[model samples]
Target: MSGTILEMKGICKSFPGVKALQDVDFDLRAGEVHALVGENGAGKSTLMKILSGVYRPDAGEIRLHSKVVSITSPLVAQAHGISIIHQERRLFPALSAAENVFAGRLPRTSAGLVDWERLNRQAKEYLDLLGFQPDVRTPVGELSVANQQLVEIAKALSMNPKIIIMDEPTAPLTDSETEQLFAIIRQLKARHVAVVYISHRLDELRQICDRVTILRDGRRVGHHLVAEVSNSEIVRAMVGREIVERFPKVVAPRGPLVLRVKDLSQKKRLKNISFEIHRGEVVGLAGLVGAGRTELARCLFGVDPFDQGEIEVAGEPRRIRSIQDALKAGIALAVEDRKRQGLVLSMSVRHNVTLASLEKISRLGWLRLGAEQEIVQKQVRDLAVKTPHIDQLVGNLSGGNQQKVVLAKWLAKQFDVLILDEPTIGIDVGSRVELYELINDLAKSGVGILLISSDLPEVLGMSDRILVMREGSLVADLERGEATQELIMQYATGSVDARVERCGR
Candidate 1:
């Protein structure tokens, strides 16, 4: 909102067989949270990397405070008061929160000795300012994903940066955690720090960002003030196409119950959780971070054992003590962390798509390459997964295509219940519409979907029914018509224990 502090003028970057960026110009004003948005392969990351000095631009000049500057490395960028906090948090899990924040740059006492007392005190002050009061001595590994991210922020702020680049910082956060992050960003804004926030969540940009820049296939497309552009317009700018509707939930008449859980309990994570998912129904699981949404999904998928529960598959009680047991009982989990759990990055699309259904694609002890290719090819075409070939490495595909490949695994099987955790977390607009269509088709085909997402609009848009969880308990259940964003948040934050009154209302 004030004078420009950082500017990348006509930047161009390229690699073998790929031009990551092309003549892109970006400017950041002090005290402004400017959004950088695009699809996965649109070079948003590439541009930011150049800004952070990770990669040198092929052709361009960077200006800081209207003066030309050379940033040869990340250290140089930091020296110039530039800090980047990546989506995958860079922290030492074994180290304490304070130690991680001051890992390389810890204060030294007069005699060239470590200053432990000062380190913890300084870290505590930053954490308190951000409204994040985790124990400074606690190992980062012991903290939840949300808290670890907060620690990451504290580390960035310790640099006393003038420019901060936050890449998908809130992808792993829940609603309340996101609010906490926003508060910290506001504090930075008050200090006149410029933030370059890179995310695929457009609504988030509207709320906190002052302006937005869109990139597509290595080229700058459009830049606009947040107040002037609508969400769909932003999508159009980023994707070069209109996203007519974000959610494509076609009415699928409900069928008989396919899964039923009675008194599901998992220590401090889930307490007496019970739910029913019928065939052709999409039940959305909504909650804030640490409200036990992912934990419940893990329990249901047999990734973690439940203390006490009755899991009924098609009216027959079954013991699901392992992942294989869960699969055998016609339950499959498309985990939240797609990069780590859902697919093997090193594997080809064909290999990953056929991973869970290997038995069906192979004979006794012999690999069936033909059957594998055919199945993967069909799935790719059906899901509209944009890939060079079925043999293409999944690691190279976009976020949306990667998610489709994860779904292809389940689509290969005859699973009665599918648990999709944060299915559209990092995907763009057009691909999200495609995914929503796929979800609707799956439900129409009598496949039950238990969608667990931190994206409230996505849940409200696609769910046939919404279930709210808070502090490891199911506090509210409501039909699609009765479930509003305000109502769900109230239940999620424990403002109301209206489970009896709100359930089925």
Candidate 2:
């Protein structure tokens, strides 16, 4: 048998104004974890979609196990022992976990009814294989995002496919969940399954991937064995530039406290979280996944109501009951999930950029098109947002550009304080640097910044002070000079005592 399980040669795909993929070539081997990596819109996803039959390649030849094959549809791909786990999961929320797992090919009884017992049994077996134990009969909507992702993986594994393609599988998972996933990948390797792993986290890829293929601007720029490639080299190949420093920290003089959260507590998530951010200062919220960082931001943004708290803005007590009220109170939030919470994909880039401050671009209760365009144009230039034009749909832009649009939307609105939750999630290394620069610039402009992220290095590098959260409580406050990876991880993983022993003091 041939060592290769899959291969695509000279693949080319294009959208209306963008060449998504241009003459890209890729290959996968049996029992190997091959990583596909690139900047957002660097044609990584496009090439993977073509391989999985989600998108028909404009021109290419796919060879399966040393033989040329045509993959016209997803069913055809599945028939050939191929499966793809999408970043955005497509689970049936109303159905039970077992039912969703055995959605299309459920075992049936002699009378043509689904065998519920067998269904749960099979689903439980699959979950067990991944070191997970959830009630198979329970509805999928009730499960957390990380659990839902595991269920998706279990569903894919149940097919007993020879090739499995996973995209950003660990984006929403915790550290433990990520470890579990790595274990599963090892098991798949033992079974000789060819795994294609796609992720933006270069460090994790080094830990799990055996080989890597990097694409840039729809072309396969480089491919190398993981042992021979460094993170900086991969980053340079993906972005076509050498980044001198990962974090660009430019400290501005701190001013008086612009906002203060006193005893902020939310149901089941945040417990008496108190912090303060001074004007022209970046305050970091550091924690593990599900550590109430996002919950605290949401409460402050009025997306979720807090049970008890006092919010003082510019030395005045404010009542923020909704997002509208928060905006009017000179507070802006750039949410974590850009697709779900930040941008309306169907709208044009111009529309999304000016969405928050429509009143500023309106005359006599009507939108001024020229004013809106000028604002968007300036933001696009300032942020270096790469798009065809302002009239282009936001949905068509890549993840990095979409995030820039979200930033632009908030920038258009005049605000005293800005809260950013995981602002660099899934973005490329270069784009992350740009975002850091933008944050520094904003902080220098006297905007109090609250940066919430699980990336410890990012928090330590960018913040003036870091506040650590455990479970639902604020456990430690560390100045930038005192914060280290060891100290942060000790608190984040709950290995250190949370009795407020003055760790970061």
Q: Give per-model TM-scores.
A: 0.89, 0.92
How well is each residue in 1-505 modelled by candidate 2, as lDDT tens digits? 1288788999999999889888988998889999999887787767777877888999989999889998888888899999888776779988888888888989998999999889999899888776666788888888777678888988888888899999888877778888988998998888999999999999899999999999887788999999998888999998899999899999989998899888888887888777788999998988888788888888888889999999988888999898876876678899776655677888899888876434453333334566777888988877777787888998788766788898888776678999998888777788888889988998999999999988888999999888888998888888889889899878877898764544222
**Each prediction's whole-model lDDT (CA):** 0.83, 0.84
Best by TM-score: 2
**Candidate 1's residue-wise lDDT over 1-505, tens digit each?**
6898888899998765567789999999999999999886688877888888888889999999989998899999999999998665779989999998888998889998889899999999877766676789999988877688888888888899999999888877766668878988998999999999998887789889999999988899999999998887888888788877777788799999889988899887888877888999999999887789989888888899999989988788999898877877878888777655667778888888876444543343234566767877888887777676888787766555677788777776667898998887777777777778878988998988999987888999999999998988888888899989999989888887658444322
lDDT of 2 at 29: 88
Candidate 1 residue pairs that clash: none
